[model samples]
Target chain A: MVNERSGRAALAELVTSRSVLVCVGSGGVGKTSMAAALALEAARRGRRTIVVTIDPARRLADALGLERLGGEPLPITELIAASSGLRSGSSPTGSLHALMLDAKATFDDLVTRHATDRAQAERILANRFYHSISTTLSGTQEYMAAEKLGELHTSGRFDLIVVDTPPTRQALDFLDAPGQLARFLDHPAYRLMTGSGSAVSRVAGAAGKRLLRAAARLVGSVALDDAVEFFRAFEGLEAGFLTRALAVRDLLVSAQTGFVVVTSARPEPIAEAGYFLDRLAAQDIPVDAIVANRMTPRFTRLTAAELRRIAAAQDAGGDQVLRTGLAELIELTAAAEAEERALAPLHTGRAIPFQQGPFQQGPFQQVPFQQVPFQQVPLLDHDVHDLGGLEQLRQSAFDD
Target chain B: MDPSAFFTGTAVHLVAGKGGVGRTTLTAALGIAAARVGLEVLLVEIEGRGGLAAGFGHRALGYEETVLAERIRGRSLRAEDCLVEYLGGHGLGLLTRPMVDSGLVEVITRGTPGIKDILLLGKIRQLEQARCADVILVDTPASGHALSFLRSPQGLLDAIDNGPVNDQAVAALHLLQDAARCQVLLVTTPEETPVSETIETAYRLEDEIGLHLGPVLVNGVLARTPHRDTDTGHSNPDDPDPDDPDAEGRWVRELGIDRDLAHAVQQAAVFGRRRRDAQRRQVLRLTEQLPLPRLEVAHRPDGIDDLGALAEELLGGLRAW
Candidate 1:
């Protein structure tokens, strides 16, 4: 039911809109590629674009053909300066840039920025709970990703920004995390543990002193002394942590943000995507679109039986099907049809189905000095590392 | 039939729950327990989270089976790798890797919409048929996606009127239905969302796929204090008598704790017990709808880090069942 013109049309709409585009899905579903493609399409149409990826794997960099990215945004200079003569030397149109999120470092920066002093910052950092939360809390990385996206959006450097999210469930965590952190910050037990000494605090302190004496009598002074020191260190910065947690909560529930659930025709990912969409709706987050990637193109003249026979023969160790490969033809056609059907309901914006490439084993060895067209780039071997690779990937995103 | 009777067969046991609910950890534990009882087990994970390997404390697992412990092995079920291996073994290795590569495997596997589910199920079926394992413990995707995977074959069969895929679909369905061969165990935490999802998944599997649902393993269940009367007729230790001034004195004297500290401890303990009782109510609700046993695995204070704790908690007392 998708309008033939809708894919490019949707990209154009996104180019002009001021809203944020958040791409979310399960791992290995071509989400990164789709985000790049959207960003590329926007840039080609003369809109300034930036695509940010929180994927730890340098797939975005490989897709963009960049060597590496830091915390800050880097210009995708190669794509703009390509000598291919197809479209070279910074078209008077616009520009594209990309950045990968380093969540732990970003969180560390946030703590330092928000803390009152060096002692307070170090105290918060040194807390076992904070260290565990900052590094390994299940959803902390994804939340940090959203925080980075918000930072980029606030900068006003680009007309459009496409964010490729982490795994689906974790991405939802990004949506829910600020609230969870707020609850932890506001817990009564946390208040009792951290507040300046009051009536309850005096009582708790007297009880603690007696408990320590009893513990010293039973298990020796060393263990009790260590515990007392740990508790004492926690008393300094409870208010500051609570304040920052509240600020982050406010930042999340703000406007100017949107989500797009990206998925393929595969059942599990589609189902997960649908679940995510439902959750997003429940949370009042706006889902602008669902991008179904790698749809199979329908073919003519080949019946299902004929395709099966070819597959069966191919399975039986025949080279005829492999050389001419009616099976591949059949598979491609079936994929297109499956994608169309799977994405039939979400045809409101656009359902761009780029041909899905195979999983790459490792990084590419050669650097192509010349302009490499996206389609001719190795289907399986190439990794999306930088802006050049992303631009090449973007070039391959249309009806061609 | 006894609900647990489903466990004593050549069945594909799918462990499904919400994220962060110890589904993967439980799957590994079930595999180890089943293996110890002499069932050759293949623990499968589709998410590529490396949870299986991490749970079993293995370095890493691949598309091929890697032995983690005695009789318990792990495999990463990559659809493309499986197709490539099947094709190469069957003599289509001559096909250009690109033609086989560029979404061809995914198309054939993922064609017919839910065909990927059928393919994944087919892969599991092949492993079962090859006597690769007596029990295939699938660390399935989360509830929604897991249901989709289970319902995929039926989805395709319904969509396509008749075809080679349909034939394959029917065969897969037959394999799933023979409860003597394959069974599904719904795993859940005692939270509102995961428990609700588990109940819905059970009904959907039964209604749609005709697969026999097994026991609901409610992991991380809280434990409550046993109620008893003291000499003073304080019927519930949780319920303090404000009328009896001696009650407070007695509590402080007996536990040798301050009134405030004792009150805090009592409140925390009571809160935990009440939470568990609420969870038990949900479990009882599930029992009313499905003719399945509910196994409660009590919450460990430190949390489940590896499979060993899982075995002790899940299978340690199952002899009574």
Candidate 2:
């Protein structure tokens, strides 16, 4: 049997290995909390740490007890900084910082940083197609998240970085982004369509010399006209976007970065996690660990009457009622057992379950991590808007 | 439950809705329901949400179908992947690889204004032509794209007079036009935006694709009943009613509780029922305007997180239909 170490111990060992720690799972799964805890643990152990989150919820700020987070890394003043000042004899071993990504803002920054001139950046940003492509595009958000992660890591600011990835599909897109972006950048049709002259004016000139003329015609003259204008606006920065994408892909392949798949113990999530693992394996992305969040441990024995009562409750009328009162308990045990069985064969790491509780009024109370190791904090009955609430959250987080 | 009864055997199933309206959930549930009766099922997701993967709890899916549940399989089709593979098959493989390798594929796939929709429709066409599955559940992008996606084959067939592309487009149009072979379901929440978008999407898909529009799955509905007034004369929203009470006491006791909370709860229940009622009324209007059968899926509080739950909720009421 695997030893049940403290959350701090498990976190310290994971970060010390110099690998990428990718936190992924479904929405509302407390991925950000676990990521913050691990980063805090790492900082306490003397490693310079950064925990970045792409989830728009900003739960990280609540988890870290900060009023807000900037786009760039800021010192985690509430924990390490405060703890260090309390007692010189008990100085923190390391430093911690946090950053919350704004995807569109980051993409805009990339365009501005790489553009040949202010005029080009303005033009590209102004273009309707570019605007739509940058914001509404399916995987662009994930790609930009990965880009930011790589940028922070390569800057040499932190020894260990924890990325709280977006929801499942988007999280996978973080890995697939580089490849997908490369294809769009290199498509010859794009180059030809976006080339200097007006698509209509150059149609005949381009026809004899280029194969893309017919395809351009297929896209229609009006749309082709619009696409060429957008591309021309993006000309100066195309190469930079390409280069950054390549760098991010290389960093992902590096040994220093490891991905940790975080999920709940539910059958669906576990299966999704397994599928994610399979795809990662297929693509050769290094998976450092799988942390199954919100797992319920099974007791040695329960009376047959209790089991029957549980089964009877499963047949309850409403989906929410059944799920909360009965299905949840039964499914939790089954999921925990299933995850343990699945993780048994893996050579590198094991599974960790962070218990969860039913919803409560306060933001911290809403968080599942507070229930782990079992000393429950009374529900705050108010929203967590400032530093004090976060401190209470931290206390609850480490309650056991 | 005859598997074929769930689907209009001759119709192409186009599942569309606003984002987060649980379109993917409805599609997966429908697929499961159809599969349970032993129909060969092909479930498709176009937005690259891989929500189908989440719905079935798989890791990831590619262009090729992966078995999700018994008798059900699914695939995620992105415009870029389809273009690369299609181009490769047509001897332009080398030309597409560098772009694919550079991560431009996703951009090109999703970046082109209407290309993603076109490619998704094309992929569905291919699925329809193949005899591998008896029913194909297409979990399309949100209504914004879904309308354009359904209309794309027709648009392409009109644009390209005759060619291999046109040939495929025409075949797709044929499959889509065949009412017996294709159907469309609009998934929505009882909320204003989603319901409005659903109606608009339904009209556009029906007009353009000539497919049968099926049901609208209204998710996250609330239910409330009058509180039982105890003889001791106390009522708590948190506490369940002890037993049936007199009408006057029930009203008075319920009124004494938190007004806003009780009102909010009542509003949600009323809103949901009203939305369903409105949808049925609109369906009647639609039948008058453009004749077709319409169905409604009741709101389930827990929402659909998996195929089993989805199947039970969606098909549970189909026996009456």
The candidate that wins on DockQ is: 2
Residue A287 CA displacement from its true place in model 1, Å: 1.6
Steric clashes per prediction: 23, 33
RMSD of 1: 31.4
* CAPRI verdict (incorrect, acceptable, medium, high) for model 2: incorrect
DockQ values, each candidate: 0.01, 0.07
lDDT of 2 at A180: 75
lDDT (tens digit, per residue) of candidate 2 on B20-68? 5566677888888888767788888775645576566575577887999
TM-score for candidate 1, please give it: 0.47
Q: What CAPRI grade goes to candidate 1?
A: incorrect
lDDT for model 2, please.
Answer: 0.57
lDDT of 1 at B267: 37
Query: Model 2, A1-400: lDDT tens per residue?
Result: 2233444344445776664577766543346666776676566657788888876545677566565788888987567654333333434557788888877788889888888889988888876567656665656778888889778877887888888875545577777676777666555545555554356535645342334433433344444444567777776666767677778777777886776666554434544455556556667765555565544344214332454464564434433322222333333334345545544322222231211111111112111222121111222212223344444434444435
